[model samples]
Target: MTETFHEFVVQRSPALSRTAYLLTGDHQLAEDLVQTALARTYRHWRRIRDGDPEAYVRRVMYHQQVSWWRRRRLAERLEAEPTERAGGDHTDTTALRLTLTAALRHLTPRQRAVIVLRYYEDRTEAQVADLLGCSLGTVKRHAHDALRRLRAVAPDLLDATAERSTR
Candidate 1:
């Protein structure tokens, strides 16, 4: 059973890491979040394996993100940097990606989580709510708020800019 759990986790780690990165836009933090979630999942693998273990782990990640955001005094630092760029070439599309991620950081942690799960992971609102342990209404509200915020930050203006930059 333990070996099965280990294999599952190893197979799923990349997917979870990508989801976490989309949620937080911080690679190191995403790695940490996924690791923490995986640790908790490992502890309860026997119980959760029969259920949707991925959803269980995702819930742990969401809760962990919310708790970390609250404890880190994020609300007070609305203008703080998202996270340092992980060293790369200076392209215009890179600039847009940074802008997009910066806009995403302004959302509440839960809203960010919702967007990541919904858009990035292609999950429905009910699924997101289930994973986050929230009411469906709350997930809808968060997703709406996140979309509104993203629109306010960049809107559709940057898509053209990004496409031009890529060429």
Candidate 2:
């Protein structure tokens, strides 16, 4: 059973790592977060192996993210700014993706987690709340707040780029 669980975790690590990356913007942090979550999941493999083990792992990741956030609020900005691209050459979609990712960086970690779970992972509010060990109301609030922040940061980039014709 332990071997099977280990195999399952190894198989799912890449996809989970990608999801973690989308949640956290840093590659190394995402890797560490996923690894930590996997280790925690392994600790409870006997009880959780029957049901959705991946769900259990994800729940660990969500709680760990929230705990990390509580220890260090996301209000502080990073010292290193993202490098600006030469605007004349980059495609609008690429630019929009970068803009959206950057805007996400401004969100509180809980808000960012809600946005990632609700949008990127396509999980419902109830699922997010369950994973985060919070109420549905909290999940809704976080998602609403995150969306509002994102909209405020890049209104034109998010709303008006369908027919962007940059020359």
Candidate 3:
């Protein structure tokens, strides 16, 4: 609620939004995640203002996402696409985007979190473990399984050697 907090929100909201989208794989859910995280951050502004508030917000978002995953039954039917393109990453082709999205859909919440935190956020395995509050071995296991599933679902995503010049 302070001026600095407002500035922090303005500065970090875009990156937070992108990460939220990657985490939820749904635009509306991502927006809600970011909003909830920011609200939590605001509540703890006095305590975390001197520290890395963004990290705190991200941690909150991740925890909230897990709880949401728990509440929602995984048996829900799959839709062709969750939402229109988030329009955040223009470099990736639509085919690759859709394939990756579908591939991600095949993963559990933890596996998806590992993949997103490690690759999209460029977090180290140890960091991912810490973020998810799991052992390093668990993080590695989730990552391995997630990649295996990604490979089975969308092999092209794993084969980086191929040239994808969609020009």
Candidate 4:
């Protein structure tokens, strides 16, 4: 049996939330992104019920995010506040994640979206291009530029060891 919209949301929210979080890099913004996508999806649920509603919602989110970024000409910048640590449990992985987040912030929304789709979401270049409504060459350019920017911003994240080996 096909699932209801509410049931679909309940079952898929966590995965959607994670994707939104990766796209926006803020918990609150991620929640808002997911909510906005879901609301749009809800409005057209009847027509899209037999189709891939999840893909439709994700496409809306990607387009919405890109449109907002274009209008704003910048992503939202949130200052990190100091927090009390319960113990000395911080590790290298935590530091790496922080660095990666900061690097992602430096990328343009389109570049970041390409990176997320191509690498994080494990989508092919053609798939990303199709989803973003761009040509495959555009996807390749974005991926190249994003990687270049990321390498400049966080050399450690993009296979520094491989570079060293080649050199």
lDDT of each: 0.82, 0.80, 0.83, 0.81
lDDT tens readout by residue for model 4, 1-167: 23699888998899888888778877787898899999989889999978988888888888878887888844589444323357744775565666677788778778888998988889999999989999999999999998998898778866644544676
lDDT of 2 at 29: 76
Residues 2-116 of candidate 3 have per-residue lDDT tens digits of: 8999999999999999888877777788899999999988998999999989989988898888888898832333576545656656555766776687778788878888998
Instruction: List the candidate 1 regions with Cα displacement exceeding 4 Å.
Output: 73-96, 156-167
Residue clash pairs of candidate 2: none
Candidate 4 lDDT score at position 40: 88
Native-referenced Cα lDDT, model 3: 0.83
Cα-based lDDT at residue 132, candidate 1: 87
Off by over 4 Å in 4: 1-3, 73-75, 78-89, 159-167
The digit string of per-residue lDDT tens for model 2 on 7-38 reads 99779988899778767777777887899998
Off by over 4 Å in 3: 73-77, 80-92, 160-167
lDDT for residue 14 in candidate 1, whole number 0-100: 90
Instruction: Indicate the residue-level lDDT of 63 in model 4.
Output: 86
Cα deviation of 64, candidate 4, in Å: 0.7
Q: Would you list the clashing residue pairs of candidate 1?
A: none
Clash count of each predicted structure: 0, 0, 0, 0
Choose 3 or 4, whichever is better by TM-score. Answer: 3
Candidate 3: clashing pairs of residues: none
Using TM-score as the measure, what is the rank order of every candidate, best first? 3, 4, 2, 1
Distance from true location, Cα of 34 in model 2, Å: 0.4
